[model samples]
Target: MASNWLLLRCRCGQSFGARQGTKPSCSRCGESSQITTTAVFTDPNTLTEAVANANLPSEISQQIENKLNEKKRKKLKSRDIANAGTIQRILKQSTDERGVLTLQSLRVCLDIEGVTEPSAEQIIGMAELQGVVHRAGEDEWKWLA
Candidate 1:
């Protein structure tokens, strides 16, 4: 049977494929890159057991899983903030008689349930990147449209 290879991207933007259980170096930067696996297999007939039993301890494995889950959750939140009407609503609420919106005021106006200030800032950064808003002063932002 043919061995399955996993694709990896290096920090230098180089992409390559490597067989399982191997750490490949980036051809362009000569930096060692870690392999990321997407699936877990408990079949006794497969090499999964050996891989799981390898030098990786249960504690390290749990930490890695937690970090991956948090990363995925943050990515989903960013996508939702970008696609949702968040930018429009913020702009509408912030553009009033004052004609200026401070970052703190914008955060309060957003009223996103259970959202942290850092997460709200990230969403605002994404909006700025998309040209939906721009910084007018140190703590103020001006709506583009």
Candidate 2:
């Protein structure tokens, strides 16, 4: 199948994406110059990744890429947890009597559940993204959902 998105580089050196067959003004310079199409991506995530990588300096790209991957994994893992009706249970199991979830509690809960991919920190980050929890103190989160 043909790609749905095109990655383009503007004269001002900004990298951006546009739908195929459409000309988009530079998001940075807004000059609407005839920018060269750099690559094609099949999905918005891949397109976003391309644009982000293009905008980053080569030396630090790997580090930033690692962080981006962690974020992506956390989002995916959180969605899985929510879909499985386990977010509430996990939150309950991982939190204390005061409804505060600690990293250690989450680790033990996940260990019991055999969910070892995301790790405690990633699960906590994901929970924060779902708006179900927020940091209440160092190494602990309070229920928001």
Candidate 3:
């Protein structure tokens, strides 16, 4: 069947299922399959020229600047960086050959004095810092080191 929408594959190698609009998850694994598309120019000069000629509404320009500044401010948070580094270290030390670091293993490695599954965002943040672990086949992780 022809679809105006593109078929998107997640980092985990899962394909999105059919839905009225966008499928929320993979039917086999229930993993999220959000798709993002953008146009990219290979030549820096081309991008610079396009931006220079682009018309911008005053309000939209101000809003865009505000968002960029907000992101910059957030990057200054000490606690977030410290935690990301800590998790990166633990993952490097503890992950096994199968690349399946269970939630239990992670909790012990991090020594979370309290109880709860690690927040998905926190797990993602750690992976972001380490740059070696990414969503792999099915529910497994793909570790580089």
Candidate 4:
């Protein structure tokens, strides 16, 4: 027996399968729409291909792409910021300078440790986000705690 499933693409880029004749809601953004029989498929492969070629309205597609990119950026930012070694190095290097941290100082510390991982900008960005540092000037950073 051929199994029938409805393929759905939400404005937020979330895709899922649902039963026919049901109004499915996007888990990501809470948008819902009634399923049409034309969107139902018996073959999963054909459903995948159809979803890939589906001509979404340009505005909706753009919104979906932007949401996806934002999610990716946030994930990377969190990963970079959560590096314990980097945070400890920055804190240690800033101690002698009366808690005044600079991008150059952080870079030098990373270099001395033979860790050329995250760039100076990324480290500084993470520090700012953590509320441990703030811009003192164009090229200087003040350590908050």
Candidate 5:
């Protein structure tokens, strides 16, 4: 199928996306110079993001990306610790007689704990990686201890 997105770079140093088969004027300068198509995509949201990222100066973009990534890693690390403790407490309260912790049970526990992020699958995967739990069935986990 034909791509619905076009990544256009203009002579004015502005980069943006447009519909395929069409040349859009530079978003930054109205420069009608040759528009170069650098990339194509089928998804409009991703295309929009690509255009925005392209418009950013390379050095500034790199710094912003690095800062965002670092903050995300830190936030996830702290939240994961808090969430792991909450999950373990929930498991003790909610694990089935066979010691299986179902995703549904995890979700309910998360809801009660007022935690909205780090989905149940994410928590389970983190626990599994930390050797705190293991998959016992298609949709359940069993405590390692």
Candidate 6:
């Protein structure tokens, strides 16, 4: 007996390959669709969009942003700034990395000391406001200071 192959549809109206005798939903909108083909793999981008657009908790978004940024570098990538939590984490990390971190140190940690990315200035500003670190002088800072 020939096994029926599985087919899936995306919300975007596109069709993709699925395994035989397997249950899978649309790769785009994530809606379940009728099987029309035997073997097909959904577009990777479509799957990515589907997962990203799904109903997710705010914390999940933060985690995603954190994972992406940490993968990139010591500084926040330009795209990472679009994510508020990533920016917040970067600012917090700036202060936390040192015992007596300073604005300059924050800037250095977030920008100059590593590869340049986005929101360097904004992070520096935010760190100044919320970071436990403080400026000790023209070139110095105290964490408790």
Residue range 69-121, candidate 4, lDDT tens digits:
88876666645443677667655775444667777777777666545457778
> What is residue 93's positional error in candidate 2, in angstroms?
0.6
lDDT tens digits, residue span 1-145, model 6: 4443334445555555454566767654566654344333344454434434442454477799998888775454554333556555555566544454445545655553343444455555555677644566664455543
User: Local error of candidate 3 at 128, Å?
Assistant: 5.1
Give per-residue lDDT, candidate 4, residue 33: 61
lDDT of 1 by residue, 1-145 (tens): 5556545555664444546566777645777844344333333334333443442464487789999989877876754443356555655675656566676776776565323444557766876899877889888777777
Query: What's the candidate order when arranged by decreasing lDDT?
Result: 2, 5, 4, 1, 6, 3
- Backbone-clash count (model 1): 0
Which ranges of candidate 4 are over 4 A from the true structure?
1-82, 94-96
Compose the digit string of candidate 3's lDDT tens values, residues 61-106.
Answer: 7689999987865764443334545656666555666666554456
Which scores greater on lDDT, model 2 or model 3?
Answer: 2
TM-score of candidate 1 on Cα atoms, chains taken together: 0.35
Q: Quote each prediction's TM-score.
A: 0.35, 0.41, 0.30, 0.39, 0.41, 0.27
How does each model score on lDDT? 0.60, 0.80, 0.51, 0.67, 0.79, 0.52
Better of 4 and 6 by lDDT: 4
In candidate 5, where is summed lDDT lowest over 10 consecutive residues? 76-85
- Among all windows of ten consecutive residues in candidate 3, which has the lowest summed lDDT? 1-10
